[model samples]
Target: MDVQQPLALLGGLSPAQFMRRHWHKKPLLVRQAIPGFKPTVGRAALFELAGREEVESRFIQHKEGQWLLRHGPLARRSLPSLTTPEWTVLVQGVDLHDDATHALMQQFRFVPEARLDDLMISFASDGGGVGPHFDSYDVFLLQAHGKRRWRIGRQKNLALREGLPLKILASFEPEEEYVLEPGDMLYLPPRWAHDGIAEGACMTYSIGFRSPNRAGLAHEVLLRLADAAVDEEASPIYRDPGQQAVAGPGAIPAELQDFARQAVQHALQQPLALECALGEALTEPKPNVWFEPAEAAGMLESVVLDRRTCMMYDDQHVFINGESYLASGPDAALMRRLADERRLMPGDLAKASDDALELLSSWCESGWAHAGLSG
Candidate 1:
């Protein structure tokens, strides 16, 4: 993708320009961002997905001037009548399960894949909404079906209503409002408070970005570093015969303190530990996700990566789903192509050496990738 090339999705601004001028700085409302767009999952299909154990879903109902929310594993009987208004069912991470939703998500690859989260779909009746709230991460709210009236602003009052399951803003101040039609989109940065109400029946797709908190990142990285450190056979101890202890018996010795600091430094000194940890942390599956291994050996002529598989690369290693492998030569080039393109075409896979083919077949059997047959 050309960052400098103007895209209709960005209201004709180049991705570079959009990032510089709009991303996280403010909100952008793009009309017809996806022209003639339709929902990837129909209402019935969405309801079906909501019933599955693997999917996370919620139902919100506003009736008789009261608000109610329910967590799902919902049966069709649990839902409101089709003719009823002011109800909604929201499904998170649709892209991980549905191929069409996954394909739709790829259109936003101009954004770094590592930061990209997943597509969340909301199906609502008239007046249905989760309520006024702000997200800590950036989001692109695309109107996939019908219409939604949105009121958004840069809110200062972050106070929330007490005793509610949802974190709803108690005092909302809107500076802008828009009724988004099908294909229209609104991009909002973190802490930009917003609310959307279904004008009638509506479906919205939120393409959210991940923003890992500093402390959370440190925790994950340190855990990974410690795991790596445990694997090292040599356990060096502090040696300072010339050093004198502090006067207080309770005080820690300076030499031992230095040794502890040095240990931490040494753990971080491993050449690619940080990089490996980052890839692994980002690719860590949500608690409920599980993969079943495939028995078939993948075709040498072509292969396609699984949607849940995360593949990334650095100078000396290729990382996939929290595992890293040293990469070099022709095989490295081929694997890097697979990471970038998300699939190996027949021609591209044909270029792989026999050893590369064997490695790819192993990956397929492990459920990381699948055979892509030739026409």
Candidate 2:
């Protein structure tokens, strides 16, 4: 995407301008984020996806001053009738199941693929809502069908109501309100309290981002580092020559404390370990994701990554599906292009080395990518 060029998705704000002015700091309400947007997946089709075991789904209902929630592979019969008031069915990771949804998600590729998560579809009946809740990640709620009434606030007190199945705000004080029609969208920053209620039967598509917490990131990085450390170092267990007994048997020994600190230092000191860990972590697919191995894609001319494939690269390495490979020279450039654009033209691979071509063929056979997909 041309970051400097105006995009209707950003309300006529160029990507660079939008990022500079509003990204992660405030809300952006675009009147027509996608003009004349017709939903690719209809109500019946979405319900079909909700029935699949691999798809993550949820049902929420507010009936007679009570909030109720349920998990799914929900059968169609289990869902409330279309005429029923105050009920919703949310299907997560819709992009994984529908090709058009995946294509829809690509329009937001102005953001880094590493941070861009999946699109979720929420279908609701009249008066339906998940309640006043704040998310831990940024989100763009795009109204796909019918209408929704939204109330937003910059709340400081992040308290939840008692004995509720969902995390609902105890005292929601809305500062602004809007009724969104089809094609309208609202972007909210992380922890920005907001509520959306269906004015009638409506469908909304949520484009969300992945924000890794500091401690959680540290844990993942350390795990990756440990795997590297085990392969590179095989140190003997500690043994003290000078006999010393501690008065407090429960307390850890001073020698052990020093050992622990040194171990951490050694892990951090490994060359390029942190970079490798981060690349691998960012490209790792979600737990529920699975890929079917492809039979030989014979005589490939060009290729495209499967929608489910997660590929990324750094200065020294290319990472995919929790695996990493050293990449350099012209081959590195070729692979990086594949990661970024997600497709390679015949000309793009004209100069690739035999080693690189063989590797790509292996990827195609493994179902990570498709062969002869270039137009």
Q: Assess each prediction's global lDDT (C-alpha) against the native.
A: 0.88, 0.90
Best by TM-score: 2
Instruction: Show where candidate 1 strays beyond 4 Å.
Output: 63-66, 237-259, 373-375
Model 2 misplaced stretches (Cα beyond 4 Å): 245-250, 373-375
* Tens-digit lDDT string for candidate 2 (294-332): 887666689899898899999999998788999999999
Assess candidate 1 and give its lDDT: 0.88
Give the TM-scores of the predictions, in the order they appear: 0.91, 0.96
Model 2: pairs clashing at backbone N, Cα or C within 3 Å: none
